[model samples]
Target: MLFAHDTEVSLRAAVALVNSASEPETMRTTADLDAFFAEHGYTGRHTGGADELAEVRRLRPRLRTLLTSDRDTAAELVNDLLRDAGALPRLVRHGDVDWHVHAVDDDAPLAERIAVETAMAMIDVIRSDEMSRLDVCSDETCDGVVLDLSRNRSKRFCSPACGNRNAVAAYRARRR
Candidate 1:
């Protein structure tokens, strides 16, 4: 793996969270947030409600900006997130997961935990000079973030659907 399991998980979660704000907006309600948290295996004090959902949604744009930023700019943004969240990294093991860093309290706000985790993951990305792994979708019609974690780092589009659409278009053009 390019990074630790938790780091990769957090990075992928950040990408999904950012892309959730794309057209057709998938995270529109508390149920959506609940599903998101569950799917990402997020553990903490989740005071689920409309306000919490909105706060999480508000973080999307900031994360998107960070993903698309240059190395230096991304580092600055990561620092800002850590500082604003008052992150204090600590290693802990829970459930089936091994020891991994958690920078915020388990009782911290969901948004703060997400932000801090993403920032902590970005620390791995930046220190490893792997910021190139973060990218925007290559599809012209999509603004989704792409986390290129593949072995060859050949992942271009955000989803298989986007890749399939482009592939089919190219095949049709070739046939014509």
Candidate 2:
């Protein structure tokens, strides 16, 4: 694996969280937030209210910036996030997941946890010189983050939808 299993999961979760804010916000209501959390396998305390949703929404842009930043800029942003959240890393295991770093309390605000976890995971990414794994979607029409986790590092599209669209366009071009 290019990174630890947990790091990759956290990075992909961050990408999903950032992409959730693209266009008309997908995470609009408490129900939407609940669905997002469930989809991302987010655990721990949740108010499932407006305040929590607001905080997460507020964090989306910052996370997006970090994901798309250059190596030095991304490193600075990751450090700032870790410091701002007062992250204290500790090894913990929950659910079907094995031991991994949890840098914030389980009772901390959900946004804070998400930010810190993303930062911690990014530490691995930066240290391993794998920042190339973070990328923007190659689709000309889609502005979304793409985590290139393929073995050959060939993943270029954010989702299968984008990939299929580009594929069809390429096939049509070949016919022409």
Candidate 3:
């Protein structure tokens, strides 16, 4: 199913980024590989030094908890991130992007920027009654988060691969 709203896409991206934490090699440390930042469209000049990278890396665990936890826990965590990031809404127009609400500045540290954008998108999700789309995969052994945008609410796996694996497992168990 298609997510027709920008906030939905943002939430999906946030979930994908948070789930990246399940594999330490992908994000590694804050100085995160240039390739990673480039792909995620995370742009801002940084000394790319140790401390800066460390803080950005720190955000991974926080975001992970946001994705995997229950509604109450996720709300509290997002609130904490917004507060700690000093988030205050202001409309911004940058490059080709139209005027959109930015809760933080252009050059705020990478982690703060990510937190603000994600928190704002989550607020949109809550308002739009789409919070149920934020979910962990139903597969028993897989802990990845799944952002389901299906019109029929049928999605249950992080990916088609995980879906196939779980389906096969289910079939085998039934046959036993």
- Using lDDT as the measure, the top candidate is 1
Candidate 3 stretches greater than 4 Å from native: 1-6, 29-33, 46-52, 171-176
Off by over 4 Å in 1: none
**Per-candidate local distance difference test:** 0.94, 0.91, 0.71
TM-score leader: 1
Please provide, for model 2 over 57-133, each residue's C-alpha lDDT reduced to its tens digit, 9 standing for 90 to 100: 99999999999999999999999999998999999999998888999999999999999999999999888888899
Off by over 4 Å in 2: none
TM-score of candidate 3 to 2 decimals: 0.80
Poorest 10 consecutive residues of model 3 by lDDT?
A: 1-10
RMSD (Cα, Å) for all candidates, in order, is 0.7, 1.1, 2.9
lDDT of 2 at 105: 93
By TM-score, the better pick of 2 and 3 is 2
The TM-score of predicted model 2 comes to 0.95
TM per candidate:
0.98, 0.95, 0.80
Clashes of 1: 0
